[model samples]
Target: MLGDDGAGPLLAEKMLANPLEHWHVIDGGSTPENVVHQIRQLKPSLLLIVDATEMGLMPGDIRFVDPDLIAELFLMNTHNMPLNFLIEQLRDDISEILFLGIQPDIVGFYYPMTDAVKKAVEQIYQALNLHYIQKAFEPLAICEQ
Candidate 1:
């Protein structure tokens, strides 16, 4: 995994500080080909990928990355493989796939994460807890027989 390319794992680290009751925080690193097998074993209802992806926006800008929009992204700072390629591998087993991409400021050795990206990480953590995760599960019905 590349240095700043560890964005998703880093974000997962910060979010795990308070620790959600039902969430499983995993740092799959930059290349998670094997992690896909683990995810398939667990069979979670939703799968969200958080990463540093340049989308031609401000350095700290965060956006919902669409699989179709992969080609248009500016991802020189990321690792060799495109995330959408990994997503495709999981598509057969994963019903819901969502991506949270943060634009990066720096992407090399020994450099601390940018203040802007840090703020975006905090914002995303709050957004996931306060809004999105709940909404994602709203449509599912529990059966009691």
Candidate 2:
């Protein structure tokens, strides 16, 4: 995890421990731009950017973050560049993008995450695992063999 700024990485750590066969998990750290190149190289059909974001919601709340709907003033994540710009660059190749965000209660310089945030992390882990497992086995062909 990223101390105060790494809730997404914490979720990623928990998710990658078991590792779903059909998915690849990468921790983008505080600056996603550094890793955007790697993601662009893969050119995956789906991209999910999970982060601890400031979306004017309650602390420890979870909400779907929409790039198009997000205003520029809310660009308070630790990254130097805007994430929407990155997404727009990959727009042509990437099929879908989902930004899952968890609101943080406190972001002090420390190792321990707050209890509310931890609960949010678990909720995200349990919920997303089921969805990914179902996604892994979906029909990929037009006609049966």
Candidate 3:
């Protein structure tokens, strides 16, 4: 497995262990495109996508990225399709779409996540947990390393 490239799945596993009250977290893996049909079935009002992205920032830095700007940010090309295209497919069903991007330190095969990126995953999990607890529908603030 590629280092911090596994961040999204890692976060999905953590969320699954605790399980959110209203949120449905799916570990789409390397083929997120495969989940589009399932996501459409759920028809959630808000869709949050988490992934390790290359944003020219520090390894652990996290940002709330616009889907339209993902290409410019140079997201990791591990998915079956471009992320923006995926977002476009779900746009009609999902009222709000949020992309939570974590900057990866290493993307090589079999490399484990760096300390900073691991910490970022924890921070994101906690933030999402708190966000749902408060029943907030607004976008999250940028989470720094």
Most lDDT-accurate candidate: 3
lDDT score at residue 11, model 3, on the 0-100 scale: 92
Estimated TM-score per prediction? 0.80, 0.79, 0.87
- lDDT string, candidate 3, 1-145, tens digits: 8999999999999998998667798889988988999999998998999888777777888777777777754566578788988898999899998888888899999998899889988888887877742232223233421
Question: Candidate 2, residues 8-113: lDDT per residue as tens digits?
Answer: 8887898789775556788887667677778888889888787777655566777666666445445457666777877787678788887776777666676578
lDDT agreement with native, every candidate: 0.68, 0.69, 0.80
TM-score between model 1 and native: 0.80
| Residue 75 displacement in candidate 3 (angstroms) | 3.3
Q: For candidate 1, write residues 65-141 as lDDT tens digits.
A: 56655654434435457777778888889788877777787878778887888777777787777756434322111
The CA lDDT at 128 in model 1 is 75
In model 1, how large is the Cα lDDT of residue 48? 80
Q: Candidate 3, which segments miss by more than 4 Å at Cα? A: 132-145
> Relative to the unseen true structure, what is the C-alpha lDDT of residue 145 in candidate 3, on a scale of 0 to 100?
15
Pairs with steric clashes in candidate 2: none
